[model samples]
Target: MQDSESLQIARAMRRIPRWWLIPVVVLVVLAGLGAAYWAGTSTTAGTESTPPLAAVVPVSATVERRAVVKQVVLSGKVVAGAESVLQASHAEGVDRLVVTAVAKEAGSHVAPGDLLAVVSGRPLLILPAGVPLYRDITQGEAGPDVESLQTVLTSWGYACPVTGSFDLPTQQALGFWYKAAGFKAPTASDPISQGEAGSAAPKPSSSDIMFRWREFVQVPGDTGKVASIAGSGAILADDGVVARIRVADDAIVARADVVQAEQFAVGMRVTVRAGSTALDTTVAKVSSFLEGEHSENTIPGKDITVALPPGAQGFAAGQSVTVTAGSAATESLAVPLIAIRQEGGRPYLLVQANDQKNDQANGQPRRLEVKITAQADGWAAIADVDGLLVGDEVTLQ
Candidate 1:
């Protein structure tokens, strides 16, 4: 009608057709994003399809260091204590021995029923050689100075054999008797000088030979680290102390007069002292030095003892040691035999925590479970010390 309503108002003012204003700009951007998510500004667009967050970077550790060989300067000294042999314990009557207790002296400390030298074996002289009107075990006989006192104790070696033969070791080396015509100390004093008895009888020197050979001691402790003192044992009974003083000040004891009798034998050579050191030991039997009824068949020197190379406790028993026998025993440590790493295949070495220690202990790493066991000479002994403790410090992987 007026040009068809002016051509539909000029096509609706000619601007709305960019796809029709895209549904009014998508409904005003969904109402301004729901009013900016209800005014809480910006934070609610999760539709749950995530699973894409990764950055990974952890697995490092270390600690394995052991190398203390101060150039390896080992050391060893403390010697002397080895010797054995002694015998005799019967054939009776030959003593005036009177000693009352002296038990184990001469670098002393004794065990095995201890108690040495208590004696009185004097009673020997059974005459009839010429019906000299004499009694037995000595209640008579001692004129002709008893064969000039058994030829001055068999010229002073007293194993006695002077042929004045009335036996009993010439009545136990008879020190001074013959109070015959009665009333003591009178070798017929008819001579403060029977004219020097034709002068000539002083020939027994080494102090007239007297050693009764009895020192036998040393056997107590010390097997601290390198053990092997064998089954060891000892037994005998005729106890005696003060084994030696020598030069006649007269303290040389054990059945008095320094033992002219008291013995035992059979492979004897027992001596095992530790500290300064002394081990020349071996034993099977020996015992009897004196103990009763006119006590002469004396026997007391054993209860059990034997040792052939097995003892260590640092040592102490008159302490004087120095021993090294047969020799052979080794087991040392200090490793590094190939970066070690095998797991179940075996060959392992784990202990690198100081951050894997590329910078060693500096990388601040960690790891553990070692066990190289043995490589020897080149040095290696790690035997699984994931727990370690011998100066702890290892690393080779």
Candidate 2:
């Protein structure tokens, strides 16, 4: 009875689901094959594919012959080259004098012996430079000052000899000058007082001569323009300035500031520009002193002066301008700044060849050694180079 029961149990177990076990076994086999195929494909793709090498960068520029000028640009203003002040002393001991008439206005041109103004109802004439007028010049006076007076008198069509002595001819010339200027003729018997002689004792004059020498205002030299003038109703005091004259036409100059004073020197050429006008000039002076008041935060700099050429005209004082101080030009083969490369303290330039196959196969760029002589305006002048010519294409990188 026990054997029969065990046999029945084994048959029941065998008949329970043989087809379901077959499908489970096939599913496990298919999963193992799929995983192996995926692993093989991934390994093949990783082994076959590799990153490409870096491609050649391309840049090109034309080589040419040009002028390279190194220049320093600065902002500046127009000013007078030379100036002189006309004071009340030009009209003698006439302090607190009223301006009766204005012969020339500001911006008017003037020459020697021109009427600048009328002070105290008398003409103030502009004359050439001579001895300062301390007192009235008489016939007995004789010196180099008298010689200067005779020279000027002769220039004005008067017949006088320049003997450095106030002789008869000088006195006659003084008379002619007085008559021409509408003044009283000098008399030989005029008293020579102690005050006029700058002495304590008074003396009598032997000659009849008395010239109003203090009535004239002598200019320094050359022609000038009236920069400023007092109105007709203004009162002039002792040593007070009546007008200001400047040498503007032929002696115009420019003032500018620079960070480096050693880079500039006197007699260096410069170009000055005002609006649309431009003029060539030269540096006349340079000062390194800091003048006047300034804030503590301000940076110190040097001042430079440039004299304008005579051809530059119609420029007004205080006009805004720009100046460019340049070095000597260097004529040579030049290229753009980007085309140059520096390596190991040496400069070089890459040149692009016309043949592409060789460049692609070799992967080596051609370079030329160069010495930069001058650089300006985004270009560099190069020298001491071989195998390079004008119009050749150069690579930047």
Candidate 3:
């Protein structure tokens, strides 16, 4: 009977379909995978290290007094300013100006009464700042030029009176000046001194000297350094320029694009740099830029001129430099541009109310209306308004 039952069980197992067994096997594997997933999720929930997200906080800045400055750096060059040219003037009975000797060369500093050159065997001296020589000043002539000469002579300790008349004392002063310059003074034309029609050369009177306008040239200013002088043998006509003078020091000239030049104005302060040296100066001038066709060799731009301040040094013409120029507003309350908000086309700021106990600003930001004086370089210069004070914190919204 046992054998018969075993055979019946075997038949029953074989009668089961293979597709049904496959379903059972799949169910068991899925159950195992679900259990593993549940265990892993529980473990991760208990030991996870990530913290919860915190509340969002707004950024803040401080309101303080400062200047809103806009600056532009440009390539520049040191150049010489306008200069005065020394020209030869016409003399009485003289047809040409012949340079015989040049006592002062280029780069020589000259002052009044200094000998500069010898022209046509006559010493050419430097006169004080005045009008140009127009005519010969005789011994008895009275004029404004004679008075100026007398004043200069008196200043040099010659003890001459400024009477505007070329008198004996003036003549004596001229003689002394000529003697000091290593030249003989010419005397007035006295026929009595011409002994018997050229029996001997006429002897100049001891107390009389005539002022010849050709012997001196008026320097344009008090003093100047000679830039260039004519050659010793160069011949020139009247009104011909003999030498050039640099009356002032070097200036810095910078070129800016037409669009960038609109911000540059005269009297603006600027910083000039060359190599490692920096100088502070003011803008002396600004040249206008006209919109037109430019030649290939010309650069289309506006020129910015900056003059060296008094006592400036270590600068030379033709040197390359960097110029920094721009505009600046006076000291006023300012804040970052991000801190400023606009509403209805009006500028406003969000300021945090201070906690009096700890001086900490932890309260809600309050909206404060402000007037923007100027804005530049990510900063807005503002005028003080109601409830706006320096040292107050502002929200960057």
- Clash count, one per candidate: 74, 6, 0
User: In what order do the candidates fall by TM-score, top score first?
Assistant: 3, 2, 1
Better of 2 and 3 by lDDT: 3
Span of ten consecutive residues with least summed lDDT in model 1: 222-231
Residue-level error in angstroms, candidate 3, position 81: 3.4
Kindly provide the TM-score of model 3 when superposed on the true structure, using C-alpha atoms.
0.57
Report the number of the highest-lDDT candidate. Answer: 3
Clashing pairs in 3: none
Per-residue lDDT of model 2, residues 15-100, tens digit only: 88767788899999999999999999999998896889999668789999988987777766777457778875443344557777
Q: Which run of 10 residues does model 3 get worst, by summed lDDT?
A: 190-199
Q: How many angstroms is residue 300 displaced in model 3 relative to the true structure, after the best TM-score fit?
A: 13
Candidate 3 C-alpha error for residue 13, in Å: 73
User: Which lDDT tens digits does candidate 1 get at residues 205-324?
Assistant: 221221121111212221011111111112223432113221111010112111322221244443444445444544333334334334444333222223333234544333333322
Ordered list by lDDT, greatest first: 3, 2, 1
Q: Which runs of model 1 end up more than 4 angstroms from their true locations?
A: 1-37, 44-54, 62-97, 100-104, 108-118, 121-344, 348-371, 374-397
Q: What is the C-alpha RMSD of each candidate to the true structure, in Å?
A: 21.9, 9.5, 11.1
| Local lDDT at 248 for model 3 | 73
